[model samples]
Target: MASRKKNPSKARRYSVKEKEEILRYVDSVNSKQGRGGQTAAVKKYGISALTISTWLRGGGASSFKIGKTSSNGAGGVIAKLAAVHAEIQAKEKELASLRSQFEKLKSSI
Candidate 1:
């Protein structure tokens, strides 16, 4: 049998602040679900279970028992959140403009 090779990917480095953010998010989600919210971290963040495990292991002591997570997990979540927020804001502005246009059309008729 031919052995499958793992793809080579460079590990991303994260700062202390960034790591805290990821753990914070994880903590927040875990809190809401009580002991059943472990999957929230991975699902919401699109993070892999293995990656999250690594992060938790390296990111100080966690009250919840998880595998591990990298310090960069927080940064990743923050970055994703920022992007989503920007997209939502942009859509809101566009919606406002469309509503205004509709109002103008109605008023003109």
Candidate 2:
């Protein structure tokens, strides 16, 4: 099986200060011209709209949690982490299955 290479430009992390600055800029623009400032901000900062919305809804980067609690009170960061772990496990299982198939074909040849 060929090895998978990590993409260098996959995800980017921004510092708290940078996020605050971007939020402030977005606020200023929105206050001046009404709505759609988030789109403008995304274009200016090269960040995703969903990320900005998360920051807005989560009350800034410091309090930002990947998953927020629901009515059941069994969510938040822990839930997000668990979800990611499950995804990784599923992907690994698929990879193993593919590898087994490849090995079977190689031996038959």
User: Across residues 31-101, which tens digit of lDDT does each residue of candidate 1 receive?
Assistant: 77664334776677665767666767654434222223322466544655666799999999999999999
Please give, for residues 18-93, the per-residue lDDT of candidate 2 as tens digits.
Answer: 8778888788888899987789999999899998987777554334334344211235556656878999999999
Number of the top TM-score candidate: 2
10 residues in a row with least lDDT, candidate 2 = 64-73
Q: Per-prediction RMSD in angstroms?
A: 13.7, 20.0
Q: Which regions of candidate 2 are displaced past 4 Å?
A: 60-109
Please state the error at residue 44 of candidate 1 in Å: 2.5
User: What's the lDDT for residue 93 in model 2?
Assistant: 100
> Which 10-residue span in candidate 1 carries the lowest summed lDDT?
63-72
Number of clashes recorded per candidate: 12, 0
